[model samples]
Target: MKAKYRRRFGFKATKNGPALQSTIVKACASVVIPALNEAKRIQEVVAYALADPATDEVIVIDDSSIDNTAMLARQAGALVVTSSMLGKGTSMRDGAAAAIQDIVVYLDGDLANLRPGIITSLCLPLLNNEADFVKARFGRGGGRVTELTAKPMLKVFFPELAHLAQPLGGIIAARRSLLQALTFEDGYGVDVGLLVDAYLAGAQLAEVDIGSLEHDSQPLHDLTFMANEVSRVIFNRAKLAGRLHVEQVIAMYESQRQVTAGIDYVLSLRKGRRCLLLLDMDGTITPSRFALELARITGNEAALMQMLDTPHDDAITRSERIAGLFRFVHKQQFEQTARSLEIRPGVVELVNQARRAGFMVGVVSDSYFIAAEIIRRRIFADFALAHTLTFEGDVCNGQLQINSAFLPDDDDADAPICKSNVLRCVLADKTPPPVELIWAVGDNLNDLEMLRLADNAFVIDPKSPKLSEEPGIAVINAFTDLVKLLGHEANLVDQK
Candidate 1:
């Protein structure tokens, strides 16, 4: 993308006398840019900020960008500082701390159509004593998030500031004193929070037009998280002001509960050799539910319910109790029951498609290894990880041995023996793939953590009520839908 970069020279005092100039200033100003994986556009932005003679320094806060953003920014004559993976708010504050100037101007790094003199326009109001903090208003106005979320919340909580346009614009300039006096929000709420706090603190605020500005919009999956954080900060501030009743607060939480969160399908042309595809065996790959099948076959449906209903401290104890109920059933009978369960439609096709797409498919389940392995062999999966059931002379024993691989490490003892731990073991190989390249498919309560851990997950069973309601997970009605989903992803990669 081409951007306009205007070159301007420093102001020179005439021989006659010093004249009042509003276009240029002699005071020092620090332009701070918070960047993450913005290597393509950071250089242009850094050069633009340094072109102004009033700018004494340019600082780019690298927020743990995986790309070469820091190196490129330094090449463009900007001081680079590394920061934690907290978010943009932390980056901005860290950059401010490293600055030496009293006046600070913040600009985004990923603008495709940024015009000339944006920094000057934002800082001029603050320099002329017309405003304590100035926010930029550019062409093509507010985004969908600002219009749908921030504006309505502002109208209710901050009516006096409702008339302003693009309240969440990141381009801003403020005095050191005013900037230090405000608290920064953690995520997407930072921009709007600063504006609200500044107005409430009795500081003069101004909005300046900086012409047309364009940048990338976040994917739909990320917008859900943004909306949650933005809503949280706004409501917390409202409650602190004593503007909400106790019942109202409870209702608000109930209304906007974040049940599920899905990952963005990032499009990339780079192909890797291996991808860990974790599939849940019980309700996911098979049509019949595991526990229900066991209960029906053993004629102990009431006993199974009693064991399940009894409260336990952790997953290990719960699994032990559930396994103890099947002491009398023979190993052969259990295997027969497992094989009788019908495989979900499109099971083989999806697995084959993933293999052709360069994925190492495996089964990570909470069921017994005997049954999981049987299904794995039938479908020709690469690997299987599950609990081991003990048997002597073809007779099933009451004792159940939990898979050591599923156990949590010493650092986190309380963590459940969930599929995520199995995933961790898979990733501990000599050449493990990054989390972004991993994909998961599962259905049930135990699969929740694993679904959240993978880059993108598919909940392939419609009967799973708990998993279906969760946000961020892509809940599909049938296993056939996965073929289409993966095909779409492949097409996107091909286009890129």
Candidate 2:
């Protein structure tokens, strides 16, 4: 998807470029390039920044480069400063501190092919006061780590940021005041973490089309380390914002480490044609039941139980009423609690096994998007579908937006949100691979339609005694049993 700017306070563009240029002169920008052993490309990048009319100064943070990167930057007309051999985050902090201009523009030193006028373009939004922070989006497609790790997590937790084509892009410009107040995450996450912090702090954020950017891609093995640090920063921010507790952050970090380590193992295995692997997020994927933490935190277990028992006539109504219970609960509290839940022991193994066996593993849940996507990344699901909750900064505003993909077909106002429709739509779209059979797994009444629609369905809800004897539904005590089921099916397909 193309990156769209998320402007607050209804900013409108004026046809007064001359006037805006005047403002740029007043608010001088210092272009800061953080470098590490970029002797070949630093000179050109530095020259481009220096030539921009809006820029009053240029600073390069040489991160303990053993080469002549610092000397080259100085020769190219930039103030060079040395940073400790720590990480990019440290360089960013040090560079910002050394800047004397009102705005700071951060550009990667290794950009081999940078378009002219890109620096001036990135500074316009800040000069006119339309944005306090601006991220540059270029024409090149983002990397695999972006598509695989960063995008999914952003879609789930920070939906407002989903439109950004390159959330991890190092080309960004922000007000010096905002930059000073923000925390810089070390390594690969510095870019994404800055964007998230800016958005959550209610800063006017914009992304400019900076034409095309060309830079060298990292080696395959190094990408795993990059993904780990990036994922850690994403979760670490949530913890600092009170969206996740300390234990939850540690658990998430450890799980992602396993994900990185197992990347080679999963890719080396031969994958097959498409089959279906549908999963539910709340209790089926995790240990505890749904919304149990919310009730416990607010001391409203009785209220929660009443809402569950007192069914509203329609899905919208039911969702709206349930959301009302969280109005008093801060979004941070809700998110932190959700992150604290641990996944089932064999869940990740099952997902990896399914993928290696040519199954299209997807999470289809009636739960909110944040929880669904977070769990999806932990287990490495291909895609996910879930409802979105609205939030202002760090607080939920008691409003819920149901996913239009799963909305009921008819005009029955009282009808519930049906996952069966979404499942059918997904199956229809998988035409090339042609899904031979579907396997649905869930733990509650909300999954009834989906379970019935699947070729094979399993009820893993230990608490639901009523579903134990349901016809055509298999009841399983442990998720590890799916390995046997898949193995048996593989034999049948082989015979065919």
Candidate 3:
């Protein structure tokens, strides 16, 4: 009966039964290429792969490429596997399985600028046990996503990987031990997914410069899709590692609340006592909710939320994240849409009233000076402390040149214009030493530390639900409520 079934199915029966066996042959190294319509570039890439002395074999998986990619790769001395399904992730998995070497190197087919050195650079770290995985970095041709998405995400969630630049670069090499243990996602996010997986798997990773290599640039419409996939990979890895706990999530939310409440209390007391009031534009007076709105408009809401969920530690530089934010804004042209943003109601009136009360009212927001200047002039603010954006003629240079004076030095001083430091400066320059009271209000996690240092805290309409749990924090639904709480007539004109 078994023989008859085998004959009917066109299967050859062997003496060792038909069960799948663990094929674990080990060679020096194997190069795997997941090619899709790369007939013209496959040969050159294969030649580059073969040039490395450590490379014992090359495997190319053609995922139903419309071109003669498989034929070309086979002709170039590579073992080709034809995959019925498409996707770089699936092709990579197929190629990895076919690799007979202890070390596996994966390279993209479109690397027209391919050189022999890249293979060595990718494989050396893995071969020497210095790293279980190696990522490639090109001097001139790296993707903007590396600087904007991967680096910032790493800086926030996994600070150890922050120093490993180009965390999302496609070219990588790893030991077979590590490759077999990972779960590769099928999409443009495969590279980032792999890095996060490796990190969570306790594999040491390093980045190596592979010289300059050119590839196609993705369109703006593709960014949201790419960001979503990348975020999925990151969140999945974090979840698998038990890093995203409910308690920690709650704490982050509460911190945001405490800070917001603290800011409100300080501002309210100052308004009552006729003291000068200064507020930071971003995350202070005006909420950072505009970014969320922009993300919603651009269809990147999921990606933005994922980023907001990541736990940021001190190791991550705020400057780098700020740079990423600027890039994100420029890419979406969100600044042009600022006129439509909704401010916390009564903020303008609060500024005006404070000024009328003999207070030097102004803003100290981290928003671009140009944008803040518009708000400053409109509200008749006395001064604005903001970063000046660098521009070439009329166009933006996409780089933020923060004034050096704002950066904190090593003399037991914090950032020169940080919320607490700014408040201190205002007190020293304008008010008597040991002023009656210092009040501050805000609405995000970033404001928590500064709020804790203040005499009173007030939480406003908060984005995070955790704020409700903060001890001794006064919560208000509207800015007018704050005015009433401060023993002043409600400013109904600015009410939303």
RMSD of each: 18.1, 12.1, 22.2
Over the stretch 1-496, how does candidate 2's per-residue lDDT look in tens digits? 0001102111123455432343344337888999999998998787767656566788999888999999999988889999865789999989999999879999999886555456678888887889999999875336667755776556555668878878899999999899988989878899999999998888999999877676777888988988887788777766676666554444333333222222222221213355778887777888675466677778877887787786545666766777777775676676677677788878888888887776768777777765666677878887667766655544666777676557655656455568886665555441233556788888887787888888889878545766676677888888898876786675555466
Model 2, position 237, has a per-residue lDDT of 66
Q: What are the runs in model 2 whose C-alpha is more than 4 Å off?
A: 1-27, 242-496
| TM-score per candidate, chains pooled | 0.47, 0.48, 0.48
**Cα lDDT of model 1 by residue, 99-215, tens digit:** 888789998999765655566667777878999988898743365566556655666666677677788889989887887888887799998888878887889999988766767
Task: Encode model 3's per-residue lDDT on 245-341: one tens digit a residue.
Answer: 5644443332222222222223322322334445556655666644566557667677666665666723124443443544434522545545555
Worst 10 residues of 3 by lDDT: 17-26
Please estimate how well model 2 matches the true structure, expressed as its whole-model Cα lDDT.
0.73
Clashes of 1: 7
How far is 164's C-alpha from truth in model 2 (Å)?
Answer: 1.3
Q: What is candidate 3's local distance difference test score?
A: 0.60
Model 2: clashing residue pairs? Answer: 243-336
Each prediction's whole-model lDDT (CA): 0.71, 0.73, 0.60
